[model samples]
Every structure is written in structure tokens, then in C-alpha cells.
Target: MITSISTQIQLAARPVGWPRPNDFATVQIELGELAPGQIRVVNEFISVDPYMRGRMSAAKSYSAPFGLGETMTGGAIGRVVESASDAFPVGSVVLHQFGWRDVVQEDAAGFKVVPEIPGAPLSLYLGILGMTGLTGYVGLTAVANMVPGDTVFISGAAGAVGTAAGQIARLLGAGRVIGSAGTDEKVALLTEKYGYDAAFNYKSGPVREQLAAAAPEGIDVFFDNVGGEHLEAALDVFNPGGRAALCGAIAGYNSTERKVGPDNMVNMITRGLSLKGFTLGSYLDLAPEFNEHMTAWFTAGKIAYDETVVDGIGNAVDALLSMMQGANTGKMVVRTAVMADVIR
Candidate 1:
């Protein structure tokens, strides 16, 4: 029998506006033994996302708030180290919502075993091949109803979902794909690497002006990640009968004051545009479809992705804050020290 000490991060205080490092606390617990039907895992990658900021708040949302003084939960991938269940033996890779911990000991039912793809990093399961990728696929195909030759626009285009959205749009036979990022370097990456037809740095000029210059013919589909000015810009440039998928409102995630909506909302009535807001929970039924397409695209070498990894469980809160501030190029994840010993 092997005993292990798991270092876990707990939410100490609910945050107001931007979360501070003091809002979280790190604690260690000894895993003395595994009970019946239990499995122990050493986490490799833990996901940090924009949606998590919403969970930190006490307000009502699509998901329940994280309990104060409890270990936080989100997407994580790891390999089983010990197991009492035959279904999940030692050495099996698994994905779960155990989150922010270097190791986890839980019932086997709480984790799902996933295959290890040869030559691919297991961390990919937390990003391009996982929920992040699925979000982009569903937002474009189902929510926005993007079709062949439809001109598409994506805000926050250098981030995980945004990068995936741009490439997915091109593969879906979009006539043109435009994107907006926070920096000039990201704008270049979008055009050179992610297959975006045009990209602009949102900080350079007004979003509406940049978008209008990029898409002179007007956009038919809008995959919105940043709201506020970006949404207003989309509304200003949308062609008649345009459709939009409201995937996230990252722009105002940390705003202490109530955010004002897009001023050009009346364009929806005048131009007969359709805007639908969605949370991934309601659309999880499309996972199979998403997996099929994403797997094929990835296998065929049509997908490109990036990950900004923060090393150690202690830095998880810092990683999340950096992602919200547009510091990460793609999906931002935390890599535990245990992951360093295992390359694959």
C-alpha cells in the first residue's frame, strides 16, 4: 500500500471584481488508503477558463457556484495510480472534474477513462480535442447555423475557442473568416496559422471600424466570445438575416458595475438578425457529432492549437487571472509537478 499527500487548492473567499491570490488557499491531505470501488489519480493538466470567474461569484448562473472553503472543480486529466475497480486499473488515463489538485482519490464512477493517443500530448484532451474544441464546433454549426459561403467573424480569435472557431469556419466552407484579438502579434498568428482571412487588434482602433474594413462585404455569421464593443461592432456590420452565437462575454467577466448591452441592438430588428445565447450544458447532446468531426479534422492535419501552460498547482489562480486578462495565446492550463515525470 502506498500513501500519498495531495496538494489541493480551495476557494477561501468569494471574489469581488478581479480575483486576488488571497481568495484561494492551498492545503495538503494524506490519501491513507483506497476504499472499495475507489481509484487514485495523479493529475497532469488542470483547465483554467473564463467561465470559472462566473462560478466564483454567488450570483445565479448556468452552473452552481463553488462552495466556500471547498476544493474547486473543473476539467482535469490524469493517469490512475491505484484502483480497487477492475474497470479503471492502474496506468489508465482518465478525465474528470476533480480540478486544482495534484492528486485525487475518488470513487471510480467520478472519472471516465480516455484512450492515450500515440505521439499526442494528453493535455490536448483539456483543450483542442476536448470541451474547448466542442464549444467552437457547436457554436458555429448548431447555434449560428453557419453554412457554405457564409462570411464569419469571431471575437477573441487568438484564444482557445476563438482559434478553433476560425479554423472550423474555414473548413466548413465559409466564404471569409475575420477575427479580433487583443494584440498585434495575435492578429498575425490568426492569419498565418489559424487560417483566418482577416484579423485585427481590437486595441488598435474601434472594433466597428476595423471589422468594416476587414469584411467590406459584411458578415453572415458571428461567433461572439468578447461581448461589449465586439457585439456592438458585429451588430453594426451584420448583413440582413445574419445569425450570431453568443458563446461568452469575457469582456465584462470582471466588471464590478452592470454592463450595458450593445447600443446597436436595434439592428437585430431592422436587419432581421438572429442571436442565440447558449451554455455548453444544454448542447452536450452534440458531443458525439462534435467528436466525430473534430477527430477527423485533427487526424487529417486540418487543426492547429496552442496552450499556455503554468507549471504547478500553486500557480493555478495566477494562470486563470492571466487568461482573463488576454495574456494566454490559446487554452491556458496548469501542469502539476507529477506530470513532469510522465512525458506522455
Candidate 2:
């Protein structure tokens, strides 16, 4: 037996406005023995995202919703400890969708083998060089059609994808990068650390006012995360022929009730604005290209990334909940020592 210590977070109840203790259950599971074509992955870190909240609900959407009394699913990074296939070795690092579990046994077909980096941290592959980075790249380049000399604005500016979006836009020769974040601290980090030209706190007042103050002339590209009011606000201040990349709406994820369409959506027609929503899964083809650009940016120190890593895989549930609530400063991740414990 591998004796892997697997901590699984399960759905206890469907939450309404916020995920309470009743909505989550952290339990231990015994990982099954490895077999041919199967690899035993000792999970190291897991990503906590706002979109997972939509999956927890029974509502119809693109992805299948998470069922009641089942293990909550999300993305994670792991190491191969025992492999049954010739293609996979015992020490290969990989990224997979195994949720919050500390250990997993799976076939080698679906996993992305992480390449080794000489000067960078391995955990960075889970952030800047990973899916979130690709999401930002594709959303900015393909979805928003961002161009040089275009002024850009981003919502949820302090979070994972937003950080990458702003920096990537700068790398693309954006004229100005403006962002809105939940707290003053995050707003400061956007302008101070991430090279955003202007940043404001959306929580302080109406998003429209904050954005107007940040980009007085008008925004050319809007990378939206907190939809609803922020979407409405973006529509109001966007220039003619402006582009809006609709990413996750972390603002409305906790609400069980349906939100009314933004009142300012009509402005899209009048102003000739384009609002395009896309998930990272929609642009898988660009992953390799994104990695090349991102690695170069990181090497040149032209782009910097941030992350908020919570200790212990057991805290994955809480970390995910916190991420949805805007508690994390950057990419929210849960780190685990379960592989070491299992090897011991």
C-alpha cells in the first residue's frame, strides 16, 4: 500500500450568499493502489478559484455542476511517486484537475507534464507559467484584441488572473493600465508593484466613479472579473469600439439568486462596445505560445507575479472560500506536506 494521506473537501450543503461551515466537509480518504497506465500523484499545491462556486450549484452552465455529497473539484499540482506507465517517471511534476485531494491515482493520459525551470520556482508553473497566465494572454490578445496605445482597465486587479492580465497588457505595449481592486492595499499593489498606471478601490464607492477617476478619458479595453455593477460601470465609461473581456464574476459567485442584467448594457450598442466572455478552456491551443512569452517576460523581469499560498491541503476548502470572498492578495493556493508524511 502507498499509505498516502488524502484529505478531501466535500460538499456538505449548497451555500446561498457565502459558503459557511455547513457547506464544506474535510475528510480523509485512502488512495487506491496504483496499476498499469496509472500514476500515483502526491499533490503539492491546489488552486482555489471563484468559478468553483458556480460548479457547486445545481444551475446549468458550460461545465457540469458539482453534485451533492461529492468531493469538490479544482486544479492541482502534484509529483509522480509511483508510475505504472513507460511514458511517466517516478519524479515527474504534473498539473491536473484532482481538486483538493492530497494524493491521487490516475492514468497518465490527461495530465500536463511540467517542464523543469532552471532559475524559477516550480510552484510558479502553477501560476504565471500556468493556466491563469494563458487565460490572461488569450483574453487580452484574442478576446479583447488589445493593441498598442490602447488604454486598458481590469477589475479584480489584485487577484491571480488580473495580475497577469495587467502585466501582459503592459508587455503588449499598452498605453496605460488601470485597475480596480476590493481594498486599498490591493489597489496600491496594482500601481506600486504590478506597474499599473492607475488603480482604485472599488469597495470605496461606485465602480463607475472609481473607474472614471482612474481613466478620465475613457477605457479602451476592460478585463472584467467582478461583473454586475462593474460590468455596468465599464459599459458606461468605455470608449467607442472598446473591448471587454468577460472573465469570472467573483462578485456574484456567492449569491444564490439570479442577478439582474446590468442597466448600462444598452450602452454596448450605442457605444459600439464589445463584451466577450471566455473561459481558459476555450483557448487551449495558445498555452504553448503563452508559456514562451511568459517565461521570457519573467526572465527579463519585465513582468512580476504574486501569490497567496495557504499552508496545508486540509485548508483547501477554507482557502477556496476565502478566495471567493476576496481574502487572498493574489493567486490563492493551498500547499500540502502530505507527500512527505506519506513517504515517512
Candidate 3:
């Protein structure tokens, strides 16, 4: 008698530029009887990332693209209701790949048991303490080779990865952290709240000039999220032997095709620059280190974050595309209806 109403969003059409509402469809589904070793979870919040827009189209990327008519792929954290196995009991929380769904019944082994954080908010798992945090940590520590006293620059400073990167760099003893965001509000938050020494709104002027002003002596490390112009600009401002942790090329996701690579490739030779493309999935082994650092930072009140949450599972498509359109102020999460009414 445990019936679950699941709201599922599927890719209806490939987007040409910006994704229209019609490009996705939200459908309500009925759950069947669960088999042994199966667990049904009521999804609380799902992530909406800039990288997901690429999955909507049939283009080659780090992860497989979503089929023309398939459920959008992402991450979600949920609460288990009816469990057919003892390993996961009712009332336990879990994390799984149940993206854009209200409730899901998957194999018990498919999910990871989330440790309790009674004082901290659950939404932290979808942001600072989750995969997004790990992405920034691994990129900075491993790929960027960041060290204490190094000057850092971050593109897309308002988004999840960018925000986390700036804070982590400061905590690791960076001398300065400069960032670029889309809006004046985000730029202000970067400097005032998130501990960035300097930040600017990329929409206001050329990225190169803005970065040069923020980092007059040049930056030792650049954590790139908004690619294209941001990437091009980083090349001009990187200190000799500086490293670039290329986390995402979000600015070019909506473009028709490849528009421009950095014109300052010559800087790579003269300055001994290194730009590396990285994904969080490739550095799962470093998750323990990231979680340890982030947990302590959160507990000690050293880290800060923001979230732009949209209510209702039906509006998931809008929330998902908003990350690409720069409509989101911080981490974007599609909040399902089960929360607040039942918890708060």
C-alpha cells in the first residue's frame, strides 16, 4: 500500500541555444511493488548544474549525453520510506543518481548512506559538502597545484564550484583570491562574504581588463568555470609557471559550436602556463580529504555559501536551464514538495 507519486523530467527536444520550457516535460509516475533489496526514497532536493545543459544535447562530453527522450541525469539526496532490505531502514537518508524525480525505487546497493550532520542543514550535501565541493578541492589541490601565498583567480565566482574554490583557496593560505561573476550582487558576495580579496562583474567590461585590475601582478592559479572569454583572459593574466584548473566550459555550452579558444596561446610558451580540464568523477579517491576539510570548515564557521532554490518538482526544467542562463545566484537545487510541510 506504499504508493509513491514520482515527478520525472525528460528531455523532449534538443536545444539550439537556450533551452525553452518545451524542451523538457515533467511527468507524474506511479510506483509498482518493490522487489527484495529495493528501497524507495522520497527525493527532497536535486542538483541543477551548468554541466547538465550539455547532457541535454547529443554531443560528446565527459559524461554521456542524454538521449533525445530520456530522463535528465544528475544527483539527488533523499529520505528512505519503505525499505525491502535491512541495510537501509525506513527514515534513513541516502544519496543517489535519482535526478529530476520525486520518488524512486532503486537497488539498495545503488545508494550511499549519508552520515548524520544534525547541526548542519541537509542542503549542504547538495552543495558545499557534496560533489561540487570535491570538484573544487581536487581541481585546486591536484590539478592547479595551489600553494600557500599563491594568488588565485576564479571565473564564475557566484556558482557552486566557483564559490567553493575561492573559499578553499583562502583557507589553504592563499595570499589573494580574485573572482569574476555575472551580476553585481554576485561580485559583491564574492568579496564581502566569501573572502575573495577582489571580484568583478564580467558583464560590466572585458574579462581581460577586469582580471588585470583585480590581479595587477598576475595570478598564480586560475580556477576556470566560465570558459571562452574567461579562459582567454586567464591566459593574459597568469603569472609565469601558473596553473589553470579547467573545471567547466559553461559559457560555451549554449553556443552553436566551438567559437574561440584562447588567442594568447603564445603566453603558454613564454610564461610556462598549464591548463588542465578536470571532472569530479575522475577524482573520487580524494573525496575523503575534501569532506574532512569541508566538514571542519563548516563546523568552525570559516566557510560561507548561497543557494537559489526553486520550489515544486514541476519547475525543474526552468531551474535546470537557469544555471546555464546565469539566472541562478549560487547553487541551484530543484526542491520537491515533500519538504517543509512534513519537516518544518
Candidate 4:
């Protein structure tokens, strides 16, 4: 007789700073019959993001910490192989938050049905057409209140959000787009691929100097991803009435010591600058609006997205580590199924 089983990665230990291989454990569980409203999904792709690092810690945050010994969760795109609900029948494609597993058995209420895009990979739901793309849109439109002809500056310019933000800023009528990345190669891609007007390697010189050189006219908007020194640098050169959407602080995610706040915070008062930190949850109400624009841009071939794919659910832990270390060029994803398993 055949049996049903699922493979999942569970948090075994909390990290003091950077996560380690020992922090996670992969286990196989025998699957049980689905309840009346539940479904069985086989994940095609799963996302590994910077925000997941914060979830690993036990500290109180905007989102709940991942429970110890429980399977880790994030965004995933999968096909419903079995379903007990009329809402989602067999062969349906769905998006859900029950990731880090090769297979998931969950209630239909948590899963959302997504329309299949022709000639598009399901992984796009975890990147450009997903939260990563929405972050850029929200930061530019709602948080920073971007206006046409505003000069925009972005830190961590080659990561998923940064790359999307640069292009989105252009589409919104930015006069100039400047970005800073860790490596020279990423810096080149920021301008050549992402349409940034000026791109610099943060490692090449002091951030303050590099940013000033890149944006001599001063920036009207700042989309921050890597905080710490980058935040201070933005503050130093912001024009009067400048606005910033403070998104992530990857610079301090793994620090054992407390990271210091920007030294030039007084600029906010003097320059009338507005800096707002946001989580995707607070801006989720804009999803319908964002999806409409993103879909249009994608269909018109105006928007471009890149994915750094690591094969197999077994390497999910390694993929997360690599992403944290900036090993990937764009959105980092783990492929749970082989090509033959994916219908789309």
C-alpha cells in the first residue's frame, strides 16, 4: 500500500546573531486525511527573504516569531493535488503562506486562488508580481508620497526590492535614480539593467562620499533597505521637504551589538524631511491597486524581474544563508519540485 508523507524544515535552535545550519532540522511526517475544508498542495517554489531573519529571533516585532519545533512559513506558489473544498478543486494553482515544505496540507481558508499567467513561471508570485514588487510600489507612492521629477536614491540597489524600486521610480517620473550596492558587478547591473541613472559600489568608498558623488543635485526621495550608515548618508544629502520610506535594516539584522541610529537625525527637523518605516502588512490594502499596475507593466514588457534559484527543499536552509550574505543577485528562491513536476 502507498503512504502520504511531507518534508518540512523546522527551527531547532535560535541564533545569537547570524543563523547557522544547526539552527534548522528537516523532518518527514506521515500525512493524514484532509479535513472538510483542507487541501494538499505540492509547492513549486518558495521564497527566502531578509525579513525572515527578524522572524527567527524571539523579540517582539510587527510579525510573530516562528514557533520552535514548528515548520517555518513564508510565501509559496503551488498546485493543489488534492482538495476537499469546492472553492479549490484539483489542478488549481494557489498562493499561500505555508512554505518551507515540499508538500503542505492546510485549510482552504489560508490559501488564495491565483490566475495562471501564460508563459510565466509560478515563482513570479514570490518576486516581481508578489510582495517584493509591492514593497517598491508602496514605498514610492504611499510612504514617500513620490512626485514627478523627484530625484530618488536607493540603498541595497541589486536586491529584489531595490531593483524593483529603481524601475518603479523611473516609471513614476523620477528625474534621476541613484543606487548603491555592495559589489562592482551589482553596481553595473543597477544602471545597465535596472535603469538607475547613477550606481556606486558602497564598498568602493565611504557611503557619504559615494552618495554625494552620485547625486550632486541632492535627492528628494530615499528608499532605504540597508540602514545604519546608509541612513545617515541619505540624511546628510536630502533636499528640503525630502521624504523617505524606511523599509528594511539588513545592516543590523545579524549584529550582536546594538546598532546606532543616524547621527544626522537633526536634518529631519531642519530640512522638514519625513521618514516613515513600514511593514508590508500595513500597506496590504493597496494590493489590488498595485497588482493592476504591475500586471500592466509586466504584460507590456516594461517591468523586468530576476530570480536567483536554488534547487530542492533540502537546500532551503543553505539558500536562506546565502541570501542573507548577499550571495544572490535578485530575489532568492528555492525550487521544491523538479521541472517535470511543474505543469505551468
**Candidate topping lDDT:** 1
Displacement of the residue 13 alpha carbon in candidate 1, Å: 0.9
- The candidates, ranked best first by lDDT, are 1, 4, 3, 2
**Candidate with more favorable, higher TM-score: 1 or 2:** 1
lDDT of 2 at 218: 93
lDDT of 2 by residue, 195-283 (tens): 99999898899887878887888999999888888888888889999999999888778776888778877888898989899988778
Which residues of candidate 2, in runs, are more than 4 Å off?
Answer: 340-344
What are the lDDT scores of the predictions, listed in order?
0.91, 0.84, 0.86, 0.90
Please provide, for model 4 over 1-344, each residue's C-alpha lDDT reduced to its tens digit, 9 standing for 90 to 100: 12258889999999889899999999999889998999988888899999999999999999999999999999998888889999999888899999898888989999999875565678888887889999999999999999999999999989989988888899889999999999999998988888889999888899999899988989999999999999999999999999999999999999999899999999999999999999899999999998888888888888877789999999999999888778888889999855244454
Residue 239, candidate 3: alpha-carbon lDDT: 90
Candidate 3: stretches off by over 4 Å: 1-3, 341-344
The deviation in Å at residue 228 for candidate 3 is 1.2
The global Cα lDDT (0 to 1) of model 4 is 0.90
RMSD of each: 1.5, 1.9, 1.6, 1.6
Task: Return whichever of 3 and 4 wins on lDDT.
Answer: 4
TM-scores of the candidates are 0.97, 0.95, 0.96, 0.97
Identify the superior model by lDDT, candidate 2 or candidate 4.
4
TM-score of 2: 0.95
